[model samples]
Target: MSLTVRILIGLALGLASGIALAEWGAAWEADAVAIAQPVGKAWLGGLQMPLIPLIFALLVTGITQAAATARGNRIAGRAIALFAMLLLAAASAAALAGPLL
Candidate 1:
């Protein structure tokens, strides 16, 4: 199956399991949380591990290319403008989703 389908399946199973454990296994709640905490943290940490270096590399590459290209200054300005607009759009999406979520 596709990655998206797998993710959806995993999400559904996770929710079902969580709900079952939370509602029917109250006594195990604390232990369950404790046991799961490290896994959650590791998942988050793993996701963050490569982001900084990847972002830095992208920034450096963009800078070098912008400097080397014809009409370099204008291109850099346009790139920054586009990047800002993208960031704004992403922020808007998160903002819009936050309240609904």
Candidate 2:
């Protein structure tokens, strides 16, 4: 089978098994947790390993592009300023609301 089909089947089986365990395998909960915890951590660590460098690279690229554009024209500078203001406002809102959440 193709990789896409294999991935889909794996996802379906995982969801099904989790639901089954939740509904009818209460006694196995601790065992499942014991087995899954390390696997979950490893999975997340693997996923995150490449993302830090990728995000930093993208951020650097975006900043350089934005700076170049901003230097070239008044309209671009204003647009970049507006974008920065909006970004700051959104971040501030999230920070203010995060504690309540």
Which candidate number has the best TM-score? 1
On residues 1-101, what C-alpha lDDT tens digit does candidate 1 reach at each position? 99999999999999998888877888768987899899998898799667655765586578667677765877776776676677567667876996698
Please identify model 1 stretches exceeding 4 Å from their true place. Answer: 1-7, 71-101
Candidate 2 segments exceeding 4 Å error: 28-72
lDDT (Cα) of model 1: 0.77
Q: What are the root-mean-square deviations of the candidates from the true structure over C-alphas?
A: 7.6, 5.5
The worst-scoring run of ten residues by lDDT in candidate 2 lies at 51-60
Q: Of the candidates shown, which would achieve the greatest lDDT relative to the real structure?
A: 1
- Pairs with backbone N, CA or C atoms under 3 Å apart (clashes), candidate 1: none
lDDT of 1 at 67: 70
- Candidate 2 lDDT over 1-101, as tens digits, reads 99999999999999998898888879769987999899998898799667545654565567668778766556555655665676567667876996698
Tell me the lDDT of candidate 2: 0.74
